[model samples]
Target: MDFQESKTKENLARSFAAECQEGARYQFMAKMAQQQGYQYMSMLIRTLAHNEMAHAQQFFNKIVELGGNQTQNIEITAGYPFKSGELLDVLKQEAENEHMSAESIYPKFADIARDEGFEDVANLFDMVSKVERTHERTLKKLHENLSCNCLYKCNDEHAFKCDECGTIIMNKCAPKTCPLCKMGQGYYRIDFSIN
Candidate 1:
């Protein structure tokens, strides 16, 4: 069977396009966060953007492997989200989109790949879906914390570290601004790495 005629090939192309758009969207959100003085938050979003681009690269590699390196203008039509707003709204939109991708879109794509005898493609979709789930959870957690104004809070006395000046303070929540650097609360790292 010709790979070019397979659904998985089209799926790969679609995935690549979608991931590229997602990466760009995340990058824009990160830029907005940075402009609003959310240093640590911007960093986290940028990391997600990079991850999305890496996913795009993986899909592109697969496409190249199947169709050769030359430009193969495989015409494809797919619906994509255009959600943009304030930082909080953007975060929420990303979380919702990631959830949809992980729970609905990718699963169906994976099933199609499997049914079409493209086990490797199915595994790729599954793996990406798992990462998307993680992204959804992480972004949702961050969104909730930010919305509640407790991103830097803890139940017990915990050390809040400043990303700019490396200042550390033990308290239930971070200070309004870093004492050393005079940076705003956003400069305090939230350690979203664990989320």
Candidate 2:
């Protein structure tokens, strides 16, 4: 195939990968929210999942329009090391993944766009990178708020278990550390038992 065709394929692959990553993240978030009884969070995650799916479809259409076949697939691998099954952990993971994808994949697509004289495509990639960056910042803020231990001090026997990080907190002594994942204590949630 020609250089343009090759470049288009590469862009499609990158976009597919990014969509897959976002989909996995949203799934995880929804699951965690359900476990934690966070109705809003769960709804938000489901919405995000739909949005990512739409983006993936858009990329697929673009690839087909460019006379390319769907050549890449998505695989949901193991979760991140710092992810403790907590909302904060989920947000952190999402932010980190978006940042990493922007840094690694976007530039390659940008290069390809430049080489193939597809400056508009390159600009689109740049716009995507910027949006991903914004998402990272928002997630970071949410993580900080959830993980903060400044105003909570409870010594109750029932430590609320954070559905996201699975950390057990006692008497507000929620260690800023997740024993399971070695993540900071900010990722822990109260462990509540139905009994």
Error of 1 at 190 (Å): 4.0
TM-scores, in order shown?
0.90, 0.60
Candidate 1 worst ten-residue window by lDDT: 186-195
Runs with alpha carbons beyond 4 Å of true place in candidate 2: 1-5, 68-85, 149-195
lDDT of 2: 0.61
Compose the digit string of candidate 1's lDDT tens values, residues 1-195.
Answer: 467888888889999999999999999999998998788888889999999999999899888887786547888989999967888998999999999989998999999988988888889999999999999987998798889978889877777889888888878888998899999988896443333
Give RMSD to native, each candidate.
2.4, 10.7
For residue 113, what is the lDDT in candidate 2? Answer: 78
> Which is the leading candidate under lDDT?
1
Clash pairs detected, candidate 1: none
lDDT of 2 by residue, 1-195 (tens): 453346556666568666866877787788886676554346556776776777677666666666545444423333333344567767777778778756866777777776787666677677767766766675675566457732123455447454454555555555554566665443444444721
Shift of residue 181 alpha carbon in model 1, Å: 4.4
Position 166, candidate 1: lDDT: 82
